[model samples]
Target: MKPGTSTQSALPKLVTCPTCGGDSVYAPSNPFRPFCSERCKNIDLGAWASEDFRMPTTGLPEDQKTDDEQ
Candidate 1:
């Protein structure tokens, strides 16, 4: 054990990447956080911009439904 290096009590949390389904670092040190890399992050952003991703449809009353949903 080096004097300057201290042992970590626990391992860093490895979160599942939303884009690639690979292990991703969820710590502050990871700039991409939930995503594995900039590429994966950008891919998710592109999907949002292209309207490829949509929120779950919740059944609403006929009057509450949006014009597009109707």
Candidate 2:
């Protein structure tokens, strides 16, 4: 153990990449974290920026709903 270094082992954990559906390393050593690489991470971010991903909601019209129903 060194002065500025902590006693923690960095092991690569398998994770599914959100953009490519592939294996990725989920560890602190990986700058992309859950994503496999810079490309996959950027792709996922692009999807968010382009509104490719959305949250599910009821199909009811906004005007048809009461204030309490919202």
Candidate 3:
């Protein structure tokens, strides 16, 4: 190792938690990375389920809803 460089520097940088923006450890070695733990992971999952995330649609097929309905 170089005099100024340490083994810790070789390791990945610390990541911030997505949900709470808190300090998080790099868990790339584990399957659940980016998230600090299972709890934070679940919180993100819940947001997806609750429609906090949305995908835009140009318009429904003409057959679906009438012109009066947007």
Q: Estimate each model's TM-score.
A: 0.67, 0.65, 0.57
- Candidate 1 per-residue lDDT, tens place, 1-70, comes to 7677766644688999999999998888899989999999999999999999998886777678687875
TM-score of 2: 0.65
Better model by TM-score: candidate 2 vs candidate 3: 2
Best by TM-score: 1
Model 2 residue 40 CA deviation in Å: 0.5
Writing each residue's lDDT as its tens digit, candidate 3 over 1-70 gives: 5697678657776789898787677756644568777888899999999999898879777779875886
lDDT of 2 at 36: 88
Candidate 3: C-alpha RMSD after superposition: 4.9
Show pairs that collide, candidate 1: none
Q: Least lDDT summed over 10 consecutive residues: which range in candidate 2?
A: 4-13
Between 1 and 2, whose lDDT is larger?
Answer: 1
Which is better, 1 or 3, measured by TM-score? 1
Off by over 4 Å in 3: 7-9, 29-31, 55-70
Total colliding residue pairs, candidate 1? 0
